[model samples]
Target chain A: MASNIPEKYKTLIKNNKRIDGRTLDELRPVKIKVGVIPSADGSAYIEIGNTKVLAAVHGPKEMFPRHMINEDRAVLNVRYAMLPFSTSERVRPGPSRRSNEISKVTRHALESVIFLEEYPGMGIDLTLDIIQADAGTRATAITAASVALAHAGIPMKGLVAATAIGKINDRLAVDLNGPEDNFGQTDMPIAMISTNKNITLLQMDGDFSKEEFKTALSMAKKAIEPLFEAQRAALQKYYK
Target chain B: MTLLYQNMQYIRNNIAKNREDGRTSEQFRDITIETGIIGRAEGSARVKIGDTEIIAGVKMEIGTPFPDSPGEGIIMVNSEFSALASPDFENGPPREDSIELSRVVDRGIRESKTVDVEKLCIEKGSKVWMVFVDITIVNHDGNLIDAAGIGAITALLTAQIPTINEDGTLNREEFVGSLPIKEIPVPITSGLINNTIITDMTKDETECSDAIFTVTTIENENYCAMQKAGPSEMTEKQMLDIANIAQKESKKIRSAIKATVKKHKI
Candidate 1:
């Protein structure tokens, strides 16, 4: 079967370079801002490469419909929408099949750090809107959402940051762009609480040797330093 | 919704004149249509009618032809009534309302022969194309059928099938061509409240409606599908009037679809 691996990418990989002219460990520029939406309890905006995401944290308030309510711990609900104008072709407005599954994982990622027991019978809602998407939009949204949650003054274990690292044309590259994501051999989008060294979220597809996986994970680990700093800076900027 | 229900007499009087939001009984809500929005999908559009927003996405994959139609491609429509869109919606599997909505829209497109399904065939029965059109409700104000129908048709019109790899995976990076289409179908809906007929009911207005009807026409030339809901009965004259109005209203909607699709041609 012909994989998405194009000859140009493979050729570039052989030369120890990437299509975007970055070294193996190089990253795209990242911008993060907190408290973008005044109506929400807390909000954030982030841009990773061409992917732009906005996240709002709504209430650690009452969980409704009776059944979803938890007596001992607050629930987390994450809804990720790729806006119709967010891509080259318009996405339909509602959640696709992947949307629900991603919500579950995103909830788990945020749940680990949140002091859910403090707000029993309530739900913290996170809404992520991808205003412009390239690839790895979910990770970018999670990174921004974490910042928004912190800005809301929700107690937490630590702030989180998300990024993806993968192999493109046999070259392990940090932060795959739209094209790289389509053609890369393997991709792992992950979330980590910066201080605990714990992997809060992990999912991977495509082929990766054990050695390659370790390298990708470690590369992701290193990328967090900058992402965590950006998150902190955004929060600090909001306070100042 | 209780606000409209609580003032039942006012709703009856309002629909007899202008709607609650002041649109004439025959007028539709303000609509903004744009196409080519989702990058990963074959075709996509975002449509907003008043406060009701919906997204339509079309994606194509190669699959076996259904047993009954070995020579034709398949088109499937799925509507998701998101819980976040409205307080009434739920967050799990599709509810009966969404299922009915999808089926009605699917029948309109299929019966109108909007897409030339035969052209989608790759091989006799071994391989053919399947088009998935998903309409997701972003915000539910009311009159979801019309909004979803508009979204479905616009996305399909703008969709392009992805190039197939030699061994049959897809080249997500490139396109083969636009899906084969013959015509576009536009759906128009009307509701009755306090014996007064109204078009495009908002969630609040829906509470006061006694009967609801939806009709879809193709290029203003023919009726392709129609559906009626509510506990009330419609007089023959009322149904005829609805048919006429829906057909006439479809003209404006079809032109909008064409212009939007034309503006963002692949």
Candidate 2:
């Protein structure tokens, strides 16, 4: 019934292109700043196009209350918080189902690359707070979390990065912005470890052909390469 | 209610200046309104009064009309005050502050008959348009009632109604016209501090006040809504003064709204 509703959005993001003039397979310009918070062991501020998020890591410490210890490996704690003034519509300050789900999946995405055995029975806390949101928040949260973990000197095989591939007007587009994500038919967010190209996170909704899925996955793999480079450069810049 | 002896003394001594910042008792804080800021809503505006900020959005939908008012559309007002705005505010369902704000805003719009609901009726007694106005407090310096009211009305004034298809389905991408608003309602709030009445109370001023008064006017002369809050007593003369000041101040705010609509070409 709302099929005719997204025509403006479709015209804005024509086939193989986005509203901001980027090609379908291209990623948004990402900037990452490491060690932004001196209070946290590790912290990173990241911006993917217009979306901005901050991640902080505090870890390898005894689990609070004592009984929640894992005994086998360090526990990963993830939290996603959006500032009340982050989006155009003020969001109530608290964790909603969306944030809870993002926090859980974000932990899973980073868990695959983290060397948890190095800090047995300790706690590793990661907080991803959104300062400004345009779209693709979960993907940027994972990207910043991975960078914050590396900055914290946590043991990890490789840094992780994420991006979204969405279908708009029957076209596969990478890094959907706010309007595109809202109007588009399908949205898929993917997270991967850059070193070995292992897909640690994958999620999608809406219509997609088998061919579209393969093309989107390959595009995500290639899109994360430059993101991986940006991650390393952020840490390197801080060290210097 | 927190009228400490020292603060009370300060307010008495500063009576000549109207406030610590030297604004006249009837003067309002700086007003700034930016429309169409929310991408998801049909109509949206972010308004700021000095340091206090609020955002308002209007969402339109089609639903069955009320049994008695089948030909008239519905307008629902709601508000939120998150902890981010102030430590005193909690995150949950609507609190007393939010409910009061919404009710006051809603009363003014309803009493003024701003939107011509009869025009909103898509089908005589079965289908009608519903307009929802949501106001969110971003910063709580003070006078949230006025800030939210302005935000809501501004958003509504700028809101566009989507085109209805032949089958009555809404075409979200294409908006046909602005909501059928009949009039503009502007609100001004005043508070009593140290026995003196003040307009546009700041957070500090509101914290120590005994009574608060708000008046909403339409076309600069008609009273649409009025509210009195807090535990302090209000003299008959004080209430009359509030009404007078509100009537005078509303003209300026209404002009501002008109300028905004003109600038936005809505």
Candidate 3:
């Protein structure tokens, strides 16, 4: 069989340890800081492993152009972009198909928690810019955006936490890093509201048996707890 | 306003009984697949589920592979929601909705390894066959994702690889064997409306839906891709329940597709 495996690494897992030297289910160190940007209404910065992202929330203000306004509830606009130097190969500085898809899913991930109905005929804008990417950038972006929204004092039902789960070298792992994501058999990014364990966003690609899928979902639930706590801590620290 | 409420009430009542079209909650709409619809294209298929219609065409060309995967060929999917498909569609560049649709369909095919891309590599890093699938929404009744996905795979299944002369001249009239297809993946979408999980949602039902989930399954009932959309949150129980429904429904759809391809002698 022709393999797309990178030649740099022989195997992703050895002796129940990942190439990054973490256990199968261990998450990379996460650091979150809120109110990072003074010019914006609210902003936050986060780093998970090598992936760094900044998220900013703009407004629950007037809906521009009038036609896009929703009388029953406010409209949400999200933009996700990776900087030119974010990856090893310099990415083009513009919205790409991948970025567009990520923006839409990220908006859906945050929409359920925000009280859009309170500001009818208004619009809330959010932007997530990836400063550095290893893997799981979407999950990192979602986590940062949640904290930024909360920092803006936007009323939300609960915080949303996200992470990626994957299978590498015939074993399931949580919070896949760069190499694991590239050569792994599966990558499933999931976002959840931790209070009630409601899933807000989910997207998966690659091979997975039904049983493996169930296991991945449970692993995602477990992986999200620390992220949820990190978000809460960031918000609490800022408010204090 | 009164009319809208009454219509919603009627839909709710129908869901309580059967569906508006008299199908069960988990039942899918009637599916129709027609292959080789676009004669000029390398391969093409038109698929319809109930009133939703989509046309997918495949075009192959010689191009250099990406730097990361120089040994494998490339497959790119693009979707267009023309104004003719629905009143809401506008004449402009691709919107986020259409981009999402294309990516979701592309994931199902790419993740399943439906096309043996390595076989299309003519040289180690110099040249490779670039397969492009363009999906157009002809009618938007509902569940365009499933319809478009089916159309794309059906088109690819019937595609023929073109022969290239040693001097790098193109020969469109002559053909090598069929494209290398390893597996077929079927995407099934389920919508949550009024706490009721319904498959094959119609346009009216989709407008009122709280959330939608799509799961793509291949042979052996393994899930290769999935996407959860809409603005509502779903409990774990609901997500898993939808996945089960997708798995069951995909089997029927796969068999139908296989039968259709067999009848066409492709």
Candidate 4:
């Protein structure tokens, strides 16, 4: 298939209209559920438009059997899984190259937000399972899982808020869904600490000119604030 | 020597009369599992049967079809037991025990036609989506079949299929909704120790028991699979006892799953 840029998209971007006809900077609706799993130490389920993710936090006890015991930090074990029915078609089971990379990157993103030093010689296992896949699984997982950890009463420095920004048809867009991601020229997933606005994780796949990447980066920074607020709101709702 | 053997026999008799956990022969340990633990997975869950902990995650991807099933998508289940969970697990490919666990769980889900694979086809006879379900045992207490089964069902229930536009594009914001879930099949596992049957056996009991049995409770009244994983043989009377216990306890397991889903308010 030829990559023909849609004329309507080109014109809409010039006029600042999104594919769904929203403003260039607008985000889709977000819903967050916390304490969703009674058995987990902390758990949350988050939905951003069609993308859905669940995060559960367990333990600050028992160092993993073989890792060198550190007296000052907790080991974070993170894994990301997507359902076969989470998308239009089915996906293969097991960690794909993409999911494995996402799991590592997400773990780093979260480590930046947690006070690992608070509990040395122990481990906290954080798992993010996607019940559905849309576009922003990594970002949604990071943001939602932080709320779950907080709900589990695990002491953390602050919440990690994340979002994806991309460029499609020469236009910058925030929170790209699956179609936009597949056809989009450049895609970037960004994670930031809500407390101090620190950029903890940044990953970009696909082609992007420097200018486009910079614009997308700025858009991602702005994109994370609402996500941070959403996490806070979810916690409030469940706590109240 | 005779006196020592007699003391051991007396201990066994006492346990047969009274369970170590203080529950009756038909009693079960507590169970709890939370769905959606892995962020990258489309549908995910972590299940706990006392101390036996299993986390299952489902992920979707678009890919070419296997030579045979071109029109329908696929659902594959993989099970891994981390060495941290037990020293018995090696660090390479999946061991036989893990494979058995995955196969049994997959059998219940696939045999029941829980997921409508026909609906998952994006472009028939050429390309289709593959649904991957990954189950990891973080803590191996006992009765993994039941824990994995619940995790798998919960993940599937919460799973959604994206809207595929006729224009050869996907409507990212248009949530087409969940796949066809014909029934919620749950597995109830019991341990048979010294001629006694107990429901939802814990890790300690399972390790100390002589045999383990799993009864997959499907629909409201049907059993899809009855699996026994131990060297000991069960008599007809003992089997009847286990079947009765499974029938009654399966309801509680199902209700827990339903309540958790409702509480998550998803």
Candidate 5:
């Protein structure tokens, strides 16, 4: 492995290639299945190529006392779990810093999309399980989980779509895979309301030059169109 | 609430020729197990039984080898009793009851030898992967053994080990799929209440039961471990009857697990 990001990223950029062999804007295959778990109020099984996420929604129930009960808005509790064997190496059990960060970001993203104010004093729990992982887990979870909530007939403002853009060798690429992610100089995951283009969650790891960041942001926004369509197509299959 | 008791009594009075929930005593609650949840962990699963839900994440790490078992990987099962599920659990270290729960769940999986521990060694006598199976009780309705066992086994079955290079580096493209376990272990708990052995006891039944009998197995026919809990002593006939229930019900649970594994093909 290259010790520094600049050297590795430069090699990929110079070769006109990505670590996963995709062009700068290509995405892995996205497959979404709705209502996999019969017990949950609503559930979805979404596979973004090798990265698999299962999102279940249970809610609009009375909130427990002692916890912060939102009388004017519903609470969203999202837990993101990646099975130890979801990757090539085993990970430590419990919430790591990365997982915790993603969980909070995912919660914020979905909370913005869901019409929580309509179900005041109740809470809706969203659980996202990553059975297989390659990259783009948080983005995949946010996308799938929103679709699940909408399918559950919980009032949702609009669909939220997310994708990551990163700087690899001074080049901007949308949707970084595991290898590119590790070696990339910067990664920015953006969650947006596809309908109104509202930004819900934004997280970036590593630094990007201002111009490079702007290019990546443009690439990420452009990448959302197809994903938004696909998410719509999935919910339509179940709801319509 | 009154209607609930009426239904319970209706089922109880007809116990001789009928069963609670309209099924035979030798029956299990509907079970659903899904794998590959939690992307950061190597393997993860969520197992549900009726209203009870448990999520288990198996994480692997390379650490200094234990002195006695330098070549073998260590399996550790940690449990979190969340007050979110029940008021009895306060936020702190695991209580004695939770500890006992963890021990019992760990014993079943460990004694079954589900994972090939020897293969987890990266450097013999220097470093080996410590597989941590963390089970979180999201809801505590009843029969966590089956839920935990299902989660643990499914997580193991879906596990993938990254290919390690000679210089102790992980080659990103190469993956060894799934832990090589000789057999998948299935556990089911049966409760004896009112001199009756019920398969897949509910929380209420468990709370009021005289004793509880739990049997763990690789399949319906092959046995790995058995646990008996509760207060009431069992007669010889009841033991035989309960064993028969375990033997019969084990097949159903085993089949469900196998079908799930086959469907997911992790």
Candidate 6:
């Protein structure tokens, strides 16, 4: 695999500890806040390590462009974007191929849990903006977006929590940082419903043996538990 | 609309037994592959899975490598969903569906290192051969991802590298050798309908499916790429079972591709 990481940072793990001093299967400090943007119907902010993302939900309102209206259910529109200043290099404004792909997959990740059938002839627009990024921006966006949907009072089967797991130096690790992501051998991002542990979104790149994939799946499941709790706590704190 | 509902109902009712096409829950539709169909391209193949048909063509060009991997060549996968393929498709820029399809297929080939990209380098950091696999969906039934994946790998396996002229220009007419291939990755897709996992779904079945998963595996029966799509959730156990099925099915498809390549004497 081609990587741009400096030669000095090639070593990601030492004595079962990552470069960031977290053990394998450990996550970075996560902080969640709900109802951050009062202008939006629902909104939330989340920070996972250095990555920060904001999600806002609008509608169950009238859908425009007559052709897109769904009579049987509400249409869900999700747009994911990384602000130009989100990364060290300025990402040009507007959708790039990578952001477009992430937007599509993020929509898939959240669509399964929302009850779009309740509001016929309506539309729900969810926007996720990455304010800062290190790695796992998609997962962070998803975790925040689910909370935003809940804060918007949308009916859902369950909250969705997501995380990325990968192999760094032949060791399975959870929640990769930027260097680990670029330098590692594999990275798999997964999302699941909090209530029933039903997987909603899964995508992987790089190589993985059968056993390694199985282990990584279990590790992702385990890592998502705290995210689910954080989402619940955020909602509860807001309601309280 | 009534007829469509009836067809969906019938499939759902008989999902546990045999599908409308007489395929069991884990069975795939008949697959046929034809190689070297396009005379203009370096390599090309047409693949059909049941009613779904797609043509994949490889065009090699001389290009500068990316700054990060200047010593290696580039492999790009692109898909075009022609409006003629299906009524739902429109003539416009590539939509999310086509983007996801191409990216997933790209992931399978790139992640598995199916093509030895390093060998295409001409002058290390300066120039290299860029392989472009362009997929055109001729017919839309279902399981386009798997079919496209097969078509891409098959076309790439048979592709010939263009030779360079004496003055540092590409000689499109002459072939130096075959493109280096290290592994064969096969993608298998399964649809979840009424809680039943079915492989190689038809158009109607895909329309009724609650969700779908595509898993790509290599020769060792280990997975290289996976994507779960649509608007439904799946349990971990169900996903694991689907992965197992993908592994088992990939072998059969890989062998089929090899036999076809051998028959064609590529």
| Docking outcome class, model 2 | incorrect
The true-versus-predicted C-alpha distance at residue A181 of model 4, in Å, is: 44
Compute the lDDT of residue A14 as modeled in candidate 6.
83
Name the docking class for model 4: incorrect
List RMSD in Å for every model shown.
20.0, 21.9, 1.9, 22.2, 21.9, 1.7
Instruction: Report the lDDT tens digits of candidate 4 across residue range A1-240.
Output: 013445543343446766666676777788999988888899999998789998998988787764546677888888888878887778787876456646666776777567788888888888888988888888889888899889988877788888877766667788887667766665667677777765555544444443454466567668788888889988998878
What does candidate 3's lDDT look like per residue over A1-240, in tens digits?
Answer: 136666765598889999999999999999999999997888999999999999999888888768889999989889999999999999999999999889999999999999999989999889999999999999999999999988887889999989999988878999999988988888999999968989999999988888898899899999899999999998889889
For candidate 6 chain A, the 10 contiguous residues with the lowest summed lDDT are: A1-10
- What DockQ does every candidate get? 0.01, 0.01, 0.75, 0.01, 0.01, 0.75
| lDDT score at residue A33, model 4, on the 0-100 scale | 92
- On the 0 to 100 scale, the lDDT of residue A173 in model 6 is 95
Best candidate according to lDDT: 6
Q: Encode model 5's per-residue lDDT on A1-240: one tens digit a residue.
A: 123345545466545666657788888788888888999998999887688989998887777553769767888877888888888878677875457646765776766557788988888888988988888998999889988888788987688888888766767788888767767665667777876765565544444433454465567678888888898888789766
Q: What is the TM-score of chain B alone in each candidate?
A: 0.97, 0.93, 0.95, 0.85, 0.86, 0.96
Task: Compare candidates 1 and 6 on TM-score and give the better one.
Answer: 6
Q: State the C-alpha RMSD over the true interface residues for candidate 1, after superposing those residues.
A: 23.8
lDDT of 6 by residue, B133-237 (tens): 999999999899999999999999888888888988878788898999989999999989999999888888888888899999999888889999988888888
Which wins on lDDT, candidate 1 or candidate 4?
1
Off by over 4 Å in 3: B1-6, B9-14
Give per-candidate clash totals. 8, 0, 0, 34, 24, 0
Give the DockQ (C-alpha) for candidate 2.
Answer: 0.01
The predicted structure with the larger lDDT, 3 or 6, is: 6
The predicted structure with the larger lDDT, 1 or 6, is 6
**Model 2 CA deviation exceeding 4 Å by range:** A1-240, B1-18, B166-168
**Local accuracy of candidate 4 as per-residue lDDT tens digits, B150-241:** 89888887666656677756554455777567777776777666767776665555655555666565665555554555534344345445
TM-score of each: 0.53, 0.51, 0.96, 0.48, 0.48, 0.97
- For model 5, residues B98-217, the per-residue Cα lDDT tens digits are 654566577667656667788777788998878888999998887877788778878777777766788877653457666767766676778766667777776655665656666565
